[model samples]
Target chain A: MSDTETLTRLSTADADGESVTLTVNGERHALRLAPWVTLLDLLRERLHLTGTKKGCDHGQCGACTVLVDGVRMNSCLQLAVMRDGCEITTVEGLAEGGRLHPVQEAFIEQDAFQCGYCTPGQICSAVGLIREGHAHTAEEIRELMSGNLCRCGAYTNIVAAIEQAMGEQAMGEQPAARGDGR
Target chain B: MNRFGYSRAGDVAGAVRERAANGAAAFIAGGTNLVDLMKENVARPERLIDVTRLPLRGIEEREGGLRLGALATNAEVAYDERVRARYPLLSSAILAGASPQLRNAATTGGNLLQRTRCYYFYDTATPCNKREPGSGCPAREGVNRIHAILGTSEHCIAVHPSDMCVAMAALDATVRVTGEGGERAIPFAEFHRLPGDTPEIDTNLGRDELVTAVDLPAESFPTHYTYLKLRDRLSYAFALVSVAVAMELDGGTIREARLALGGVAHKPWRDREAEALLRGQAPSPELFARVSDATLRDARGFGGNDFKIGLARQAIRRALSQAAAGTPQSQTDKRVQ
Candidate 1:
């Protein structure tokens, strides 16, 4: 086949699209997108919920971390079409009506961010970490939260904020943790 | 990434049908490695059959052993009480791998099928025999510090990038898979293949086969097991040379032993002869040294990875000593620099 024929064939092959419904941040959204669109792009571009940052489009950096069914995952690695009918909680869903989530508040209190680009993913991941019940000590928190990279060297404060949030959750001072109690 | 048709498989038969219908179709679960490769244009599937929602997420006891469903997430398996209690080496190996978020999204089957992290394979501009067969392997003579030292071929030198599979190889696990031909059980040692003339073939599974679960035999190394991983960083880095040692000791003598090494081969390197040599022998530094030397006897490094031969030797000794002492590394433990 000629180059033009090959290009035409590829374009026609790529035209396959799918419609999906996602329950995002307590709201429902119906969208028609290509199958290759990642969950990160769907949140930032289609839904216009730009709170979740995209550092690396691959799974290397955790800037695109989000809670899928209350479990933290790298949204960049998840295809939007595959996540249909699933509940997604991005960084935008962490706060209540004009009130910051405990993890978000702790991030501020502990000065957990410098450039603030990775703050949203960090806070959301911290909330998921607390719900997972894995981070008991500061070192364990650091090891568990290693996915969300903060290039500004705010790891010390990030661990502190997660620990503080865990303390509040244990004391029942914060609202009930997110997710379906998995 | 190239566009692809998406279809969710409702069952194992549905997944197998979708995969067998079109040779270009791919089964996607967890999408951790596949999505990355797609973005790099290393893999371009015309159809993606999502199998995440399939009823293969069970982690139950079967025939006095444990059966882990294909869709069971890495975090679920690593944090499982039964897995930690009975197979602590598997738990340690899983936790020592990727970060918490990636582990939450990555599944057991996906982890087994993860591709190599070779620089040339990801760069479409370069020649990679694994990515494009017969294209010539640039990594054979290029910067190959992360390449394989054992079970390598002239066509490819990329090492398999998985810490979990190393432990599975040591645990003597069995992989349960379903294909158009029907269901079959594959020994974990035979699941992954070494780089031969056909560098493109990674595993023994057929093109249309779907892994259902991994079964662990009813055996426990309660008192002696260790997964020692040496990496460039303390967290979120691939292994430089990792060793998984699981042995059952009676007082000071080794009753049974299983040894495997990662980051130094195309597949998990298992030394059955070396393991058998340790049987009924008393645990001592000199005995560990002899075993390590025997394991690395035929290891040959290209250029940049000559240090791995010595590094793997030391790691074998350290891991054996730790396992013998009943102080296996845990998630909370710091790097043993």
Candidate 2:
């Protein structure tokens, strides 16, 4: 997006006059935001990044989940001013050069999502889950992913996709496949 | 959705001073609760004092006992080896709450300071005395299934919404606070206040004060600890009725007992009467029943929550019996040690 468009979206004047410069998807943007404006609204309305959805507005729903410094947090529960100078990776930033992230690819391969409204949040949340090294066992995965609610009941497939992704990543680190059946 | 100003605090004292300067300033920690409240228009602060970067993050074995920093996340507190070993009840309580993502975002101090999960309190349309003073508590006349039965007054019935706090009360924990007058230690039992005439005041904390840490006292009790929570759903749902109990059994008799209940009170309801009844008494089904009965003496439930009193008593009984049965001696005898 252009700088003029970004400035046009953040039209509201700061009541207390404080400037917040935050990094979004490798782009640094400065905006004057109120202390009360949440990160969810800032990303969606200000930056025009509609990948993040607002489900409950409360922290009970994981629909507004995003990675703040590679850690998953409810964007609705965080103020935009609190994220100043913090590295925020949203669902829009997951893919690199038109290539899908491994978790996104696995999700598609395993048919892990049904009603895809929660898929972006789930994918972002899953990336954070793997980054935090919380997918050791099915129980641990279930516990870690408990925050991201999938109303479609696609949990079995989601867990399978994460497991597959972890396995593939592990295999990529090893030597190339050999023909030896031993 | 109202606009509010923001500022960053250099330290605890600076935050307190900022709060004091800004009449309606609120301290923002993990932003797990405060920001949500702001969006709902339930909490309106003119200025938000960010103290997340302050050096208030540590879990140390102190002289008196365990000192848990206010910024210590729920995940950190629950998974800390020292906390898991020394205060297993506390660890268990933290793990039993919310979920991994929430626990990761939630801080110990934030958990303690979180407002009641009472549905009426959240809905601005409803008349909640806790939210708006003299608005009249709608839960009193409306659906009060999850409201408090203990530590409640005629004005309010909202139950305290933390599971970890229940265990802390049983452990006799102390909360360290820093404000205008410097540092002060408040007993956990006194940290949270019963809803007497002023149900709006959930705690004894001053408006400018910030909770720096929670101190768990070192008590010598070879007790079996248990935290039992009964809820409608398996996860995420707050407890319908919960009990945190620690009992030291001598042979078949109870040597010492500590009991605190959640989802039934404005604070962690410690049943000293039940403790007195169980001390030096034989551990039996009848004794457990008696101990449980004594805990709910003044319980006056609303229309929807009439069954909670019975549910809580039964939960306490079952927890006590299970705790007594799961003693080390029983484990040793079963393993032929």
Query: What's the lDDT for all of these models?
Result: 0.88, 0.81
Per-prediction RMSD in angstroms?
4.6, 5.2
Best by lDDT: 1
* TM-scores computed on chain B for all candidates: 0.99, 0.94
DockQ of each: 0.51, 0.37
Interface RMSD of every candidate?
A: 3.8, 6.3
Please report the TM-score between candidate 2 and the true structure.
Answer: 0.90
Q: Tell me which residue pairs clash in candidate 1.
A: none
Candidate 2 Cα errors over 4 Å, as ranges? A1-9, A14-17, A96-98, A169-182, B220-223, B249-253, B327-337
What's the TM for chain B in candidate 2? 0.94
